[model samples]
Target chain A: MSDTSLTIRRFADLANPTRFLALSARLLPWICWLTAALFGLGLFYALTSAGDYQQGETVRIMYVHVPSAWLAMMTYMVMTLSALGTLVWRHPLADVSARAAMPIGAAFTALALVTGSLWGKPMWGAWWVWDARLTSFFILFLMYLGLIALNRALEDPTRAARLSAILILLGFINIPIIKFSVDWWNTLHQPASVLRMGGSAIDGEFLRPLLLMAGAFTCLFLALHLGAMRNEILRRRVAALRRQAARGALTAGGPA
Target chain B: MSLDAPHIGFVLASYGAALAIILGLILWVLLDGRARRAEIRALEAAGIRRRSDRPVDDARAAGPAP
Candidate 1:
């Protein structure tokens, strides 16, 4: 075989279910350990290293709420890219990666909402409100659910992939709306501090741990996604093999 | 560290909830992966067993059992 063909063969070999499962088995332990370590450090830093001068202890919610919101947005962006890869390249791993990300993204989105509500009750004097940022966030959660439902609704994997890709592409609209809503509406929620003019409005003592936690969360998601993809490939292989076995049995039982 | 700080309870609650959910998710993915892999392994072994049970000479002899 030519060098190009050899390379393709090697790549296809990795796509095999058994190979993928073996790799995942070797990798998942490290991922789980790192996830635990990161969460531990994050919690320690969140609780002990700093206390808010203004909002006092309640400000600790920032550690969870901000990072969850960031991941929620980032995960959606990653999912859309994966979905595009699924439709365009028809990459075997692409749909699995996208599907794995949805639950994590949905979880983070829900976290953002719950902690936002928790923070809002103290700051805004209400458990919930119809403010632009909050409203857009709510919509984002629904978008995650919608994408998941779209994936599950169709029987054919390829058709499900295509339909969900369209949904995710359309749902990209909510992301920018979520980011810019506070600025556009002059709402009660504070405008961007981390990404805005000058520098972050938050202090360094608090910012360090927040950034660390965000990095840790991102890594955790990466590890989980890879593991989930391995499982998906294994499931597909088992289904294929079972069908083959059934066909073999049928043929064996039939008359000439 | 500041025991006297107001709303410390809220801070504790937020971290607690985040930890609970993340840990739950991790457990779920790990268990589900293990279960699926086990199923595949079992099915594969069964396929092998079936294949091994057939005699080599019967390969042509088993053609439709006429």
Candidate 2:
């Protein structure tokens, strides 16, 4: 077979939950190890780097706070794509992926908020303020929670998946606002220093470890997401078996 | 690293919170997988297998639903 076709064939195989589970089982262990190693390296850099003249030692908090915030946003983007997969492509694992991503995204968002608050209290004089940047990010976090709650309240998995997909897409308007709030509004939150229009405002002194931490946290997100997907697939399998058992019981019994 | 540095407590608290959240997520995923696997094993052991797990020949022999 041609190489392009062969690759396409391999990619197509992952649409099967069993195949995806097998792939995740093989990939997750290595990703987890890589995440740990990268975090260790990143931490070493973060600790050894000299403190900022203005921010002093408190700057180290950025190593954790920034990455968590990035992951919080990235995971939601992931869900947005998974939402498309469910609505457009109708892939079996699309809803599974979206459902699995919600809690992990929520956790990361919570981590971002907690760590941001911890960092804020020292620098900004207050743990939080009703600024555009902070308020929008907080709303993003709440949207995740709302979608999670919506997913759980519905009885049928199919209906829940469809409704959650719509809600997720509807809720996605907050992402760009969160990204641009520092620019659109004169918030106390510092303007985008890393991914700004004219390149990073941060110096090389701090950028290295920040990127490493970002990489590590991204890997961590993938590791957790894959494991969660595997578990969801298995949970569905268990549910299917229970339904089977119930049907068997009904069939074996006489009509009421 | 300096214990006496200004605002060091905030840095420590942030890192501590990050560590706590990461560990919680890891445990949640791990324990959830374990519980599901155990449940599947119990169900299969009780002769309650998935329709896909049943053979096509057996399914054919059993015939259609009433």
lDDT (Cα, tens digit) per residue for candidate 1, span A26-145: 987887788778878887787777666678788889989999999999999998888787788776777877888888899889988888888887777888989899999999999899
lDDT of each: 0.80, 0.91
lDDT of 2 by residue, A108-194 (tens): 899889988988898889999999989999998999999999999999999999999999999889999999898898999998899
Candidate 2: stretches off by over 4 Å: A1-8, B55-66
In model 2 chain A, where is the ten-residue run with the lowest total lDDT? A8-17
Query: What value does DockQ give for candidate 2?
Result: 0.85
Q: Could you give the DockQ of candidate 1?
A: 0.46
TM-score for the B chain of model 1: 0.66
